[model samples]
Target: MQFKSKKVIYQVFTRLFGNTNTTNTPWGTLEENGVGKFSDFSDKALEEIKGLGVTHIWYTGVPHHALVTDYSKYGISADDPDVVKGRAGSPYAVKDYYNVNPDLANDPGKRLEEFQELIARTHRAGLKLLIDIVPNHVARNYEGASTPEGKRPFGADDDVTLVYKRDNDFYYIPDQAFQVPDIPEEFKPLGGDAHPLSDGYFDENPAKWTGNGSRLAKPNFNDWYETVKINYGVRPDGSYDFDTLPQGIDEEDHNVHYQFWQDKDVPGSWEKFRDIAWYWQEMGVDGFRFDMAEMVPVEFWSYLNSHIKAKNPDALLLAEVYNPSLYRDYIKKGKMDYLYDKVELYDSIKHIMQGHGWTDHIPVVQKGLMDIEHHMLHFLENHDEQRIASPDFAGDAEKGKPAMVVSATISTSPTMVYFGQEVGEPGAERAGFGSPTRTSIFDYIGVPQHQRWVNNKKFDGGQLSEKEMALRDFYQRLLNFTVKSEALMGAYEEIHFYNKEHTPGYDHRLLSYVRWSEREKLVVISNFDAERSYDCDLKIPGHIVQNWALEDGTYSVRDALYGEENVLEIKEGVGHIPVKLEPLQSYIYAVGD
Candidate 1:
C-alpha cells in the first residue's frame, strides 16, 4: 500500500549483522545462528519498532547474494582465510530472485509462511515491511546454468554486427586479444562489446565534465561502480551512443534495434520483472527497495508501477536515487513512491545545527517540510555510507556534536534509522564515499554479539559519554514526540522565519515553524544550536490561534498586537505553561484549543 503519512522505518542492519547470536560472518557461518529469524529476537525488538508508530518497516538487505565461482566477479573471496570475513555478503548481489538466504529465513520452502506470519504480527501491531530489490544490473561474474561459458548473460541481443566485425567474435575490438565467450548464438552482445575495458561508458551529461564521469578501463561493476557504466543514450559514441541511432533502427522509438543491454524495445520488461517480483511476493515479502533507479529507463517504471499497483499493491517500493531531476522525474512518473531527500538532511543537520550557515535555515527547513509532504524519504543513516557517530567532521563523539537524531525524527518526511545509529555505532569507511557505520548485514556482527553489547549497555549512561546520551535522548524524545503529536501528521507551512538574516544576533541555533490541519494548528520551534538563544519574534496570523499549549518542551509566546502576550519562563529546567526550549530542544504547541 502507498505510505499515507510519515513513517519510522527501523533499520534492521545492525540488528541482523551486529548481533552475535543471530549473525554469521562472511556469508558462510553464523556466530549465533539465525539472527534476524523470527524465532531469534525477543518480541521486544520488532515490538519497539512498532512502538515508534512507524507506518513502514524497511528491511534493507533481505535478499540472498548469488554464489559465484569467480571471486573477482563478486568482489570477494569464496574461501576467505578468516571465516568471519565471509560475513560480507553484499545484499545487492542477488543470486536467485526467489531464495531467501537460510540465515534470514530458517527455512526456504516455508520462508513466505514465516514472513507472512511476521507481517501479520507487524500489521496486528500496526506496521508494514519493505524489502530491497536491485534491478539496474545483475550480480556480475555470477555463474548459473543460464550463464554462458564466458560472461553472464545481460539480456537478449540481436544486432551483434554493430559492435563487432567478425562472425561470433565481433563484439571484441581488433587487437583486443580477448575471445568472446561461448555465448549462445541467440544471445550475443548488442553493441560496443569489448574486452570489458571499453572506453566511454554510462555518460549522457550535457556538460562534458559534469555527472558521475566516464567509466574506468576495467569492467568490474562492483569494484568502484565506475568500472562499468550502463548507457542511457543522450549524446554520441563518446557521450551517449543512443543519440546516434543506427540506420535500421527508429531513433524516436527507444524500443527498436538499439544498443540497450536489457530489452529496451520491450514494453513488458516490467511485467517480466513483476513475475520475478511475484517470486518474492510468494516469499511473503510486502515490498521492495529499487537500487540505482535513475539508471532505469522511464518506460520501465511506467510499466512497473502499474504492475505493482495491480499485484500486491500493499508492497512497499523505495527508490535509491539522489539527484533532484531524477527524484522529480521518478516521483512524477509513478515509478517511485518515495525518494531520499539527502539535501534537506545535510542542510538541516550540517548548516543549521552545526551553526555553520544561516539562522534562516528555518526557511530551508520549511522548504524541506514542503518537499517531504510532496515526495521525500527522510533518513538519518544507512548501510552504504559512514556512521553519523563517526568523529570525522564533528568533535567530541561523547559530548559536543549537533543533534542529528532529534532533527531527523522531527523533520517532515518518513524516516529511516539505519541499523547501528541508535546505539551510536562507529562503522568502517570507504575511501571516497565517507564512513558508513554498518558492516555486512548477515555475517561479522550478529545478534549474539549485539546481545552482549546491549547487555553491557555500551551506549547507556555510564558507558556512553554525555554527548552520546544527549544524542540518544534527542532521538528518544523525538520519537516519543512524533508518536504523541498530531502535528507531525499534518501538512505544515512556515508561519515565521526565526531570524531575518545571518547576522551577529541571527540565532542560527533556533528554528521555529508551524503545521496546521483542518482540526488543529501547531507551532514547532526547535533549538538546533548547542548553547545559543535569541529574542525571536513570530508574527502570528489573525484569529487563527487564541490559546496554545506546548506539546513537548516549555516555551514562551508573545504577540505584537498584545504586548507581553504570554510570559513563559523556564523553571526546573523546563517551562510549565510558558514555552521554554532547552539545548537541542523542540517545542510542539497546539493552538486554538
Candidate 2:
C-alpha cells in the first residue's frame, strides 16, 4: 500500500462549538444557558477551521439522543430526567439513528434537513464530515420518530418475554420491573428542579440489560442506566449465534470481505445496523466514528464496514477500541480504518508529560508496532480525556507543545486535536453529571478558552489573551506543516539511541529522530523538560548517510518550524549537526538543501 501524508482531524462537540454563552450554572436549561445551532457554523467559522489545516471535522453529538428537554410539540417525546444523565444528555445514548438532534436546528421539524445543509457547507469548505455511530447501545427509551417509510424502529417487533433471542433487538430480564438509580440526597435530577418525571420512577415491565452489559434489575449510580445494550447475535452464555468470518480472511480487502458476507447467514441485528450505516451514507456523511467499537462483535463490524466501503471506498472508519491485543484484529478483520492509540502511545505520552516516565520508551513502542503504525490514530485530547491545560492534567497549556509535535510527526498515522485544545481550553467547569477534568460531554456547558477564540461567532481570536493566541498559532503552524510534508509519509528511523550514546549530555528528557523520502529528508527533535534547555551535537549514523547517498561536505539545514538555520558537516559517510532547544521546544529541520 502506498503511503499518504498525515491527515489532521478536528473534533468539535456540535452543541458546544459555537455556543457563546458564559452562564455555566449546573443543570441549566437550554433557554438559560443557550445552545449552539447548526447555523452557528457559518462560512466564516468553517473557513477559520479550514485555515487551521483540518482535513476532516468530526461533528460529535449530532445524533438525536435522550435529553431532558421537551420536544413534544414537534411530535418528539420528552425524555425523563430520572433516566437521563445530564441536561444535554450523553451523545452515545442515541435515540434515533436516522434523525439529528432537534436542539441543533433552528426549526425542530427540519433537523435532518439542517444537518444535510451542514454537510454541504462542510464539503464546500474543503473538509469532510464525520458523525458518531453508537452501534453498541442506544438510549433506554429508544424511539425513531423520523424513520423513513417501510423502516421499523428497533424492538418494535420483538418478543420481550424471552431472555435471549437471535432476532430480538434487546435482551430482557423477564417479570422484573425497571428501577431508577438511587441518588444521593444532595444530588437531584436537574439540580432539585421540579419535574413530573423527576420522582425517581420509570415504567418498564421487563427490565432490559443496561448499556454496559449489566443484567441487574436496578443498576447502580455508576452503571450506564440511561442506555440499553443492543443484542448482536452473541448469546448470554458466550456462544456465537451468527456465522463467523473465515480464517485467514483478515488480510483481504473490504471488497473481498463484502463478497464473503453476501451468502452468509447472520442475525437480524446485523442487517439492521447495516441498513443504519447505509442510511447515513445516503445522507451525505463522509464517515463514521464508532463508539466502544470493541464491545460489538468483530464479525458484525466486518459485515457492516465492508458494505459501507463498497458503497464509498473513501469513507473513513474510525473506532474507539482500547485493547492493544485486539488492535490488529479490529483493523485487519473488522475493516476499521483507524483505532485509538490510548493504551500505549497516549498513556506513555501522558506519563512523560506528568513527570512519571521517560521518553526512552517511545522508540521501543514505535518499533514494536511498525507494521501497523499507520492504523493507530494519535491524539492528546478528546471528549473522554482530560484537557492538556486542566488542573488535574499538566496544569499548563504549553506542556502540550512537544507532545503534539511528536504525535503529529512520529509516524504515518492520522492526528486528531480536540476543538479547544488549540487555544488551551482548561476544562474546569463544574458540570452536573461529572467532576471537573474533562470537558463535560453530558451537560449544558460553555468552554471558556474556546469561547474567546469564537469571539461571539466572529471566528476570530479577538478576545484571546497573548499567551492563548501564541498557543493557537503554534498549533496552526505544526498542523499545516504535517499535512503537507512529504518526508513524514515516507520512512522513520529513531536517532535518539545514537545521539544518547555519542553526545555527552543526551538523556531521557530529549527525543530525536529522522524521517526521509527519495525527495526530502527531515531531522526532528523535542525537549520534554519544562525548566531546562539543551545544547548538543546531533549525529546521523553512517548507514543512513550512505542510504541517502550524500557526498561528504558542509550543508545548511533550516528549521521548518521557526525558520532558524544551522550548518551541518558531513565527513566520511557521517553527518554531524548542532542543536540548541529551549524548554518544551521542538525542531523540525529540513536537511540537505
Candidate 2 per-residue lDDT, tens place, 1-593, comes to: 35476889999999999889999988889987778899988889999999998999999999899998898889999899888888889999999988999889999898889998999999999999899999989999998876779877888888999999998999999999899988865456888889988889988779999999999989988889999999998999979998888989999999999999999888787888888889989988999999999999999999999999998999999999998999999999999999998998998999889988899999999998899999999999999999999988899989999999999999999999999999999899987888788999888889999999999899899999999999999999999999989899999999999989988778899999999888888999999999999999888888888887777998889888878999778988888888888999999989865
Candidate 2 contains a number of clashing pairs equal to 0
Best by lDDT: 2
Residue-level lDDT tens digits of model 1 in 367-485? 64465444577665676644555554343232222344334434456667665465566654221111234444423344332344344323223445555455555555556556545
lDDT of each: 0.45, 0.91
- Over 4 Å off, model 1: 1-5, 14-18, 21-38, 66-87, 106-121, 143-217, 220-269, 365-372, 393-412, 428-443, 446-477, 495-506, 533-580
Residue 457 accuracy (lDDT) in model 2: 92
* lDDT at residue 211 of model 2 (Cα atoms): 91
